[model samples]
Target: MSDVVTCLWGRAGWDRAAQGLLGAGRRLADELGGKLRTIVLGPADEALVTAAQAVADSVVIAEDETLAEYNPESYLAALTAACQKFAPRAVLLGNDAYGQELAPRLAHRLGGSAAGDAVELSVADGQLRVTRGVYGGKATAVIALMKSPGVIWVRARAMAPADAGAAGEVERVRLGIAADPRVKAIARHVEAKEGVRLEDAQLIVSGGRGLGGPEPFQKLQALATAMGAQMAASRAACDAGWVPASWQVGQTGKKVAPQLYLAIAISGASQHVMGIADSKVICAINRDPDAPIFKHCAFGLVEDYEKVVGPLAEKLSRHS
Candidate 1:
C-alpha cells in the first residue's frame, strides 16, 4: 500500500478545526507522495461530503444510525475499521475533547505511536516530526515519530485552512460495530452563553483578578458588546469565583488565537499567556507596571482597570 494521510472529520460541520486538519493532512500527503483521505463517521450529508471533497483526495462516509451521536466505543470501532482498510501512513485528528480521547487509544489499538496537541507538523528524512508547546507554553518541543501510521492530534487555529480544490469522489463504508449498551447519549447540554464563542471571536476582552469580583465582569461584558468582541477571564478570575469556568482562558482553559486580545488586570502568568500565544495582537491594562502581561502585550496602559474600562466602553459605544 502507498503512503496515505487519513483525517477524521467530526460532527461540528466542516469547521475551522476540520479545515486545519485537512490543510495539514494535504501538506503531509504531498510531502510523502501519497494521498489525503477524510473519513466522517456520522450520517451522510451532501454539504459535509462536498466540503470534505474540496480538500481531500477521497472521502469515506461511515454511515450508521448508532453514529448519529458520538459514542466512544462505536466511534473507536469504526476508526479501527478505517485504519485497517486504508493502511494509512499517518492519521490526523483535531486536538479537541474527542480527538484527545481517541488519538492515544487508537494508536495503542493499532500498535502505533501517537502525538497530541501538535501545533506544527512536517516530514523530514522520511520521519514524521511534530512541534507542540511545552512547559505550559513557555517553550516548544519537536518530536520525531519513527513508526508508520503515526496518529496526531492537531491544535486548533494553528494551521491555516486549505484552499478548495477539485472535488474528489466519495465512498461509503459501513462498520458492523454496535453501540455499547452501558453508555447512552440521551441528550446534549450546551451552555446558554450569548455573544460570539470565545474561540471563534476575532476580538476578545478578558478580565482577571484585578476585577476583584464578579460585578466587574459586567463592565467587561459591556465593553465586549460595544466592541463586538467576546468576554473572557484569566484562570485566577475564574478560580476566585469572579466568573464562570467557561470564560477562563489559560493553560487550564481554552486556547485562543484571536486577531486582537485585550487583557485587563491580568498578571500575564506563563500559564495564562500560553493560551493566547497565538493571538495576532495583545493589549494589557493593569495598574502594576511590572505585570508579566505587559512584557508580552503589544500595547500596555499601567492604569487601574476600573478608571479606564467604563469610559472606554462608553467611547467604543459612541464610535459604534
Candidate 2:
C-alpha cells in the first residue's frame, strides 16, 4: 500500500484539474509526511518542468516526439510505468482534455480503477470516497472505490492550485523516454483567434441573444478587452452569427470556471449556466425577471442591459 499521491503535469499549461491536483498534492504531502511528485509529459519538456518545480517535491520528466501534440498512447504508457515504479498510493490527474483521456488508459494499464470529474475525495473505511457532479450540475453524488491504489481525475476549477511562492531549481532527468513510430510533430501552428481563451481566462464577460444582434456584441467585446478579460458568447449568440463558435460557452461549447463570469443581456439558459458553474461570482443582466437566469445568478440586474452596460462600463473604467 502506497501513501503518496502522484500528479500528471502538463507543459502547455495544465488542464482543468490543475488546481485540484495541486491541492491534492499539497494535502497528500502533509498527510503522508512525504512529497508529491509531479510528473510532466512533454515533447518540449524543459519549459513546464521549470514551472512545476516551484510546487512539487520532485519532478518526473517523460519526453517523446509523438507526445508533441498529445498523442494518447505514449502518454498513458509512460504514466503507467512511472506509477508502477513509484508505487504511489494515489494518483491525481488533471480533469482537462488530456487528463480525461490519459487517466482511464493509465488505470487500465495498471490494472486499477479510475474515476473522473471528482470534486471531493477522502480516505474512508479503508476505501477512496469521491464526489462528482451529475444531472446537469443540479446535484452531486458520492462514490466509493475499493481499490488498493486510487486513480482519479479532478475536474477543472474544482480546487485552486497550491500557492507556493518562488519555484525551486528544477532537476532535469530522462527517466521514461517514449518510442512511438506512429506520430510526429512536424510543425506547430496556432489558428488566429480572439483576445483571450475562455478556459484560461481569469475573468470572462459574455453576451447572449438578448443583446439583439451582432451590432451590440461589440460592446461586450470591448468591455472584455478593456478589463483584460475573455469575451464569451452564449450558444444562442453563436447560432445567430453574433460571434464565433470558439467563444461560445455552454454545455456544447466549453466549460470555463473563471474567477468572475459576467453575463450581459443574457437570460441565463441552463445549458449556458452549466459551463460557468464553477465561477466564483456570476453576475447576470437581463430585462426579463423570469428569464430563468436569475435563479442561478448570484447578482441579477433586472434592467435593460443597454442602459445598465454603459454606466457599468463607465464605472469600471474609473477604477482602472
How does each model score on TM-score?
Answer: 0.93, 0.83
Per-residue lDDT for 1-320 in model 1, tens only? 44555556546776667777788888888888888888887765677778889889999888777787888888888888889878998999887778888889888888888998888889888788999988767689999987767999888567888888858779886777787787788888889968767877799999998888999999998999999999899988898887888998976788788999999999999999988988999999999999999888999999999899999999999999
- Per-residue lDDT of 22 in model 1: 86
- Model 1 clashing-pair count: 0
* 1-320 per-residue lDDT for model 2 (tens digits): 54455555555564445555776666755565556777766643454565566667776666555444566677777777778877776788876677777778777777777887787777666667778877767888888876646688876465767776535444445555556767655787775866556787789999998899998877776677667788888998899988888888876777788888999877777788778788888888888888887877789889898887776767777788
After the best TM-score superposition of candidate 1, give how far the Cα of residue 58 lies from its true spot, in angstroms: 1.0
Candidate 1's C-alpha runs over 4 A off are: 1-6
Q: Which model scores highest in TM-score?
A: 1
RMSD of each: 2.0, 3.4
Clashing pairs in 2: 16-156, 19-161, 54-167
In terms of lDDT, which candidate is strongest? 1
**TM-score computed on alpha carbons, candidate 1:** 0.93
Q: Please, what's the RMSD in Å of model 1?
A: 2.0
